[model samples]
Target: MTVRTRRLAALLAALSAFAAGCGGESDTDLVRDTVRSYGEASAKKDYQRICDDLVAKELLRSVEAVGLPCELAFKRGLQEVKNPRVEVGEVTVNKSKALVQVRSSAEGQPDSQDTLELTLEGGEWRISSLAKAQPQPPQPAAP
Candidate 1:
């Protein structure tokens, strides 16, 4: 495992220990919280938190395979996003997997909505894949 992976694993372990009492939190709420945390961490350039608390191991592997650490990849990705904001929408869960619908928009850019896949690991949800959905066209108003 890479350094980022090890960090993330440790973070997850710590979270699991504390999350035992948070069983009352709904799945949607948990997913929403995770996305919100990601946004906050991104704004602060907290790459370690992003890797440990936001994305999954697979994502880390993909970044490392590309010859960049996950933290650097996250930083590079953030550069293209101006005034980034995210709103979590519907969350669909199936067993250990989940898909969170999110609407995100940046300055001078049209809204981009996507479904973020997540996995339940160590009693916490971690982002697995980010597949961007085609932007929906504006609907015409009816009389």
Candidate 2:
């Protein structure tokens, strides 16, 4: 093969390798993606999918503990909130656990921050718990 053809083949091979490596989602991205999917599902009122797939089994159990199934309970909670919005911020992943910072708001409600804890369960990232984000102490003013 000519030198030019060899160089072109090398470039193609390198590009293919890079593409393959990037095609799969990183753990951080997977965590963010799960949160984003939850937001979209919430907007569409897809409570079943959220309970059945997006959340961990333990969370689902808690949802059902009030004598209502997961889907019905979630639907009730969201009934008054219109245009629920969720924004995913910083994400930290350690082994099979992850913490995601999320900002959310809905009609007539103030914006709020929450932390979502996720675990790698059955090869999927699922939200295990959610709690209000703790307020950070004021940092000393920079010099």
Candidate maximizing lDDT: 2
Q: Whole-model lDDT for model 1 versus the true structure?
A: 0.83
* Residue pairs in candidate 1 whose N, alpha carbon or C atoms collide under 3 angstroms: none
Look at candidate 1 and tell me the lDDT of residue 141: 81
Residue-level lDDT for 92 in candidate 1 = 90
Candidate 2 lDDT by residue in tens digits, 103-125:
88878777788999999999899
For each candidate, give its TM-score against the true structure.
0.75, 0.77
Cα distance off (Å), candidate 1, residue 105: 0.4
Clashes of each: 0, 0
Worst 10 residues of 2 by lDDT: 130-139
| Model 2, TM vs. native | 0.77
User: In model 2, which residue pairs have backbone atoms overlapping below 3 Å?
Assistant: none
lDDT of 1 by residue, 47-127 (tens): 889898788888778878999988888888886767778888888988878888898777777787888998888888888
Where in model 1 is the C-alpha error above 4 Å? 1-23, 137-143
